[model samples]
Structures are given as C-alpha cells and as structure tokens.
Target: METSKRLEQALKKLYTAFHNNELNPECCKQCAVGNILDNTDSWKHLSEYHGALKLNYVGKVHQSFGRKFNGYSPLELLQIEAVFLKACGYELPLHHKNKKPKNPTNKDILFSGLSETVRFLCDLDGIPNVMAYTKLFEFEENEKPKYEFSVTD
Candidate 1:
C-alpha cells in the first residue's frame, strides 16, 4: 500500500480506537503521542512519514481552490482544524484544550461539524451536550443553561 494509504489508515484506526475506548493512551505508556513526544527525532520521523501523504491531500484541495500550498506538518494541520472547529462550536477531547465540565444542559448537542460517532456517544452517555460537558470557561458571565430537551428525556 502507498504511504498516503498508510497514513490515512493510521489516522482512521487511531481515531476509531480512541472513540471505542480501545488504544487508551492514558492507560498504556506506549502511545503514539507519547512516543512522538518522547524524542525530537521520533517526532520528526513521524512528521516526515505522515507529511508526504498530508501534502498530497492538501495539494489536491489547494489545486481545487487555486491556492498556494506550503509545508505544514499533519499535527499542525490537525491543531489548526481543531481551532477552527472549536470556533465553530465543536469541542475537542478533554486533553486537547484542558477541558473541564461546567453547567449541564440539553441544547449543547445543537452544534454542528462534530463527528457523528462523538455526537452519538454523547447521546448514549446521557451527557446530551459535548460543549456543556467539555468546556471549562465561557466569556459570558451570565450564560444561562438551556434544558428544554431535558423534558423530552
């Protein structure tokens, strides 16, 4: 299989395992991130290994938009995506943004762009709101809890 295929497979497998409660990096010390974080050489190796494939995909998208694409590591791109999605109201996992649970509500599920698997998990867990459960602080001091959907529960 091609390198792009491998990276894509790795990404999917990693995310799926993360979602499924397998590949618990928290439990096991031999995590991909941990390995990458342990050594600059390893981090560089992972980046170059994944970078070629990431570039191919980005190149395709850039071509479509007539935009000039430059070198950015896959991890960099992922962080950028995370920031963009957070701005659009999708919460990353707890570790990404130092998340701490806050006021509980029902309408927290209304946000778009989150993966269906994550949304489904939230629903299954009775959390009903990823934003409500993962966020630590909001700028608005008088933010009110919206629980209209709680009645339907």
Candidate 2:
C-alpha cells in the first residue's frame, strides 16, 4: 500500500530522531502507538473489543524497554511496539492483536521475545525498514532549560 504523505513525513522525523540519539522516554505515554490507538476509530474499536489485553501488553513492553534502556524516543517506542505486534502475528488494516489463538503463549515469554524483536528492528537500515511501519509524525525533543546564577559581592 502507498503510504500517506503525512505518514512519510512522520517516518522521516522518527528516523532522524533515532539517528540523532535524541529520543525521550518520558514521552512514551503519548507515543505513536498510543496516539494511533486513541485517535483512529478503527484502532480504537479493535483495542476496545478484541485487543485490550494486547494493547496493555504493548504498554508493558514499553515500560520494560524504558526500564532496561533509558532515553528511548517516542518513535523508538512505537517501532518496538509495532515489531512486537507483528511478531505476535498481527497484520495491518485490522492491526488487532490476536484475541484468541491456537497457541496460547505466556506473557513473560512474549515480552522477552518481543523485546528481542525490537532490538533487532532498531538495528535495521534505511526508511523502509521493518520498524517504520507506523509512519507517525516527528516529535520535538524536550530541551532542558538552562539557568545561570550570578553572585554579586
């Protein structure tokens, strides 16, 4: 499928951020996965009806990554989540986490597997790589404000 211009722009921004090592873990709450699930009607319906646990799992995965690796960018978080979903056998359009599966896997096992998957995806090259599926927008990095204190005698 042809990617939307908006999505392309978002992917570019995400890639740039990843390259610059400027991702912020604090923004994970508002990351691309959360935003897409929250704003898109189709994703919202899927999460509400069939993928609530899966959605929750994604959050756990994010938290896991955050705890393991500090300073993850929002794009990086989304990329990891996307890789996790795909690894768990979810496809696009629906993008719903498998509600019921022939094989039931343990959450801990799944988390470990998906974490590895994210690490692998993050190491890929170029824009059209595996982790760029979501195609979300660029987030401006939060800069720490500088304060100068002067003493007069």
Candidate 3:
C-alpha cells in the first residue's frame, strides 16, 4: 500500500528502534515521537509536560511560522506521543506515581504503543492503518482466508 513519504520514513525509524530495543515510553529521546524525530528531545520544548498536547510559547511560535519536525507539526508530535504512551499503559502526564506496565521496554508493550501511534499517524495523513492485519481475515468464497497468515506463538 502507498504511504506518505513522511509516514514511511517514520515507520522505518520506529521499526528499527523497536527491534533494537531503543523504544522507551518514559524517555523523551527514545519514545515513539523521539524515534520519529531521530532521537532528539528538542520536541519536549513544544509542551509544558511530557505527555501534554498543549503547545507552549515556543511551540505556538513555531506553529505560527509553519515549522515541522520530520513532517509533523509541534501539536501533531505531542498528540502522537500521547497516543503511544497511552497505548503502552502509561497514565497521561507521565508521572512516576501513575500506573504503567510492569516491563515498559518489553516488545509486546512497545508493539501496542507503536501500532496505535501508526494508526494515529495514518489518520493524520488520511490513509489506512499500515500495520493492520485485517487483510488476513478476508475470506474467499466464504470458506478460507483470501490471504494466508501463520502463527506459532
């Protein structure tokens, strides 16, 4: 399926980070948005809190100036991070006291976050969910899957 250039690039980085065990919802430099932005924490300045969607002074200025980091506006970046963190079982605002997964770095945990983030990204670009597996559920003649998918786990 065709994906926007920016979405493709973002997916590539997210895939690499997930496989390399670099994704961490608690770390701004290694979280979903961080990986999309090449591991830079400068995006944190876009908001007052780690998981907030509200843009601060600098962020508003950049938005007014039409600035984009890796093809995402400042607000868009914050929203992406928020979605990822929430899907990863994080309590928004990202406090230590907030409930979170037992193993935040686990592959399963990260996958959930990445999947939701990708969905949100696709929605922003008006495209299908690139990570969807529904195609494997399609039936041919109401008897078998149109596409074959195997699972061993």
Candidate 4:
C-alpha cells in the first residue's frame, strides 16, 4: 500500500480540500493541481490557458530542466488540471463563456473530478487505483471467491 511521498501527500491534500469545501475546479489556487501543490496558483503559469496540456514558455523551461512540483512535472500538472476540469463539466481551457456544471460546489461533482484525478495520479505513479473496489470482491467466507468476477460467463 506504499506510494511515492508526493503521491501520498497529494492524496491527503486532495482529500482534505474536498471534505473542507476548498476544492474549486475554476480557481487555480483551489483546483486539483493547486491543492496538490499546497494551494499555490504557480502551476497556472505552467500553461498559457487553463486545462491546456501544452506547456507555455515557463512550463517548457521547467519541463526541459526536469523540474517537479509536488512530485508532478509541469506537463503532468496541466494534464491533471485538464482531467479534473473535464470531469467536472468544464469546457477545455476554462473561459467565462464555457459550459460548466450548474452547481460547481456540489459534492457529487467534486467527487467525480477527484476520482478522475486520482486515477490519473495512480497511472503516473504506476500504482493501483486506490478508488477501485475489486478488492472488496476478493473477500471469502470460506475457501471460495466472495464475489465472482463474472456470473454470466
């Protein structure tokens, strides 16, 4: 169950921010990458536009230099933000006229964004998705599988 230090810290920060009503997909300081980076808006400078994967000059420089913020590369931070925004119903490169969820602060909406961000984080760290529930099915009362993988096969 061990993960990289950054992954563990980021997950804890994300969880705390979500439960504390601090997560805001539109705010650079409160967004997924923001919270992971200790609620700093500096990551915003990594891209020319919000939700864009293409790194800006500063971002490119950092990426080229192998810089990492909170254990995520400049490009990775952008990708994480994009995934969070997209899953939260925001149009890419968030704008004033872009489509967004009716209730951005809704728990369910935030949860969806967090879920996708977590999945991406796990992928980046080459770890299992902690949000997955297949392990729940691994429990067995005796010597048989507690829950069959497929009942119709």
Best by lDDT: 3
Off by over 4 Å in 2: 1-69, 93-112, 121-153
Over 62-129, each residue of candidate 2 has an lDDT whose tens digit, in order, gives 55565322233334434554554445544532233534223324333333333444344445322233
For model 1, residues 8-116, the per-residue Cα lDDT tens digits are 3333433433333332222212122322222122322322222122334544455456542122344443332333234334344324354422421112321222233
Which sections of candidate 4 miss by over 4 Å?
Answer: 132-153
> For every model in order, what is the number of clashing pairs?
0, 1, 0, 0
TM-score per model over all chains: 0.23, 0.27, 0.84, 0.84
lDDT preference between candidates 2 and 4, better one: 4
lDDT of 3: 0.84
Model 3, position 20, has a per-residue lDDT of 64
Query: What is candidate 3's lDDT per residue for 18-71, written digit by digit as tens?
Result: 756688999999999999999999999999999998999999999999999999
- Candidate 2 has its poorest 10 consecutive residues by lDDT at 143-152
- The better candidate by lDDT, 3 or 4, is 3
User: Which 10 residues in a row give candidate 4 its minimum summed lDDT?
Assistant: 144-153
Give the clashing residue pairs of candidate 4, or none. none
Write down the TM-score for model 4. Answer: 0.84
Local lDDT at 19 for model 4 = 58
Clashing pairs in 2: 23-73
